[model samples]
Structures are given as structure tokens and as C-alpha cells.
Target: MSLEDLVRGAAAEARRLAAAFPAAGRKDDLPWAVIAAFDADVRGHVERDRRIEDERDRVLIASVTLAETPAEAEAEEWDRARRHLVRAVDYLEETVLRFGIVNRLAAKRGHGAAGDPVSALRRG
Candidate 1:
């Protein structure tokens, strides 16, 4: 899948997890599987693209932090997890926007045929 699609999916899953926080009585009640999948997806992109490494790193860190919540987490812990999810979503969305802007600028400058702006920038 495209980097954009992967980031978007991670963002969507993060948002979903945040929304589900209200019903979660403990960390285990939250979606650990989904968080793990999101981490793997973003890590894959980070391995492939140096340009987005920083942003993807932030997302990964936030998700990992959220995932590390105590099994017997309280309201405060849940709130913290929700905030981390928000951070991940924010960074993922920012990465998506950056990708769009970079791609458009690359295309306008006659570099579209070279593939994604990330690869083109690397080539330069």
C-alpha cells in the first residue's frame, strides 16, 4: 500500500481507539492488537522513508506509550492513553498533509514521473 494509505489507516485506528477509551475499564480492555498493528505499519514506513522518519517516530512513540499503560489502569491512565492516541493521530495526519504538499510541488516542478517526492528528494 501507499505510504499515505498506511498513515491514514494508522490515524483512523488511533482515533477509533481513542473513541473506545470511554468504555475501557482497564488497559487490557483497550485494543492492544490494533495498536500493535499500527506500530508495525508506521515502523515499516519509517524503514523505507527517511524524509518522514521524525514524524513517524513521534507517532510510533505515542502509540507505544499508550500501549504501555498498566493492565489495571485507572481513569488517569486512560486519559493519558487517549492523549497519546491523539498525538499519534495528529502526527500521522501531519505526515499525510506533508506528503500531499511535497508531491504536488514535485509534480509542478516536473519531478512527478520520478515517483514520490520522498524518493525524488533522496535521488537529489
Candidate 2:
């Protein structure tokens, strides 16, 4: 899927989880699942997608600076490699920050639930 689509999906899931942040009364595994998936998608792109090496590198660095696991560390490093592309993304009409809010909230929820930073990156 396109990066925008992925971010939107992640943002939607984050909003869903935020609606039930503590997950005290939730019955489904949607939040966890969505977070896991989102993280995995980001990780996948950083590791294999070559269409936008620069964008991928920037994202990977930002993500790694934000991760707390060996896997996450690796993924984040890949993102960092494309730091030079930051300027390009800034010029683009579609910014990655669109999903910033939701992504943060989701991270908090994942950390609280799984006690692992990387786990928060994923949907489940």
C-alpha cells in the first residue's frame, strides 16, 4: 500500500485505541493488532522497499530514534540512512507527520500494554 494509506490506517487504529486507551473495557484485539501491523509495515518498507531510498532512510532513522528493541533498532537505523531526504519530503504535498498524533498515542498504549516500545509499533 502507499505510505499515505499505511499512515492513515495507522492513524485510524491509533484513534480507535485512543478511544479506549487503557483498554479497560474493550473486548476486541483490534488496537493491538492494528498497531502491530502498522509497525511491521514501517519496518518492512525500511528493510526492503527501494523505490524511495531517501524517504525510507529518513523514516527509518526517526523510527529507530523512537524504538526500544533490537528489531526496532535495526529498522530505525535503516530509516536514518535516508536522512538526506527529509528536505524532499518536506517539499512534498503529502507529509508523513499526518499520522503523528495517532502514532504517538498508539505508542503510549503499546508501551503500557506490552511494556515494549517495539510492541507498541505493531498492531498486535
lDDT of 2 by residue, 33-60 (tens): 4344456544333223333344434433
**Largest TM-score belongs to which candidate?**
1
Question: Model 2 — which ten-residue stretch has the worst lDDT?
Answer: 111-120
User: How many residue pairs clash per model?
Assistant: 0, 18
Q: Write down the lDDT of every candidate, Cα atoms only.
A: 0.55, 0.36
Which number leads on lDDT? 1
lDDT of 1 by residue, 16-124 (tens): 7666654543544445544554566544333244545565566556656676666587878868877876876676566544553234433454434324533323335
Model 2, C-alpha of 49: deviation from truth (Å): 14
CA shift of 62, model 2, Å: 16
**In model 1, which range of ten residues has the least summed lDDT?**
113-122
lDDT for model 1, on a 0 to 1 scale? 0.55
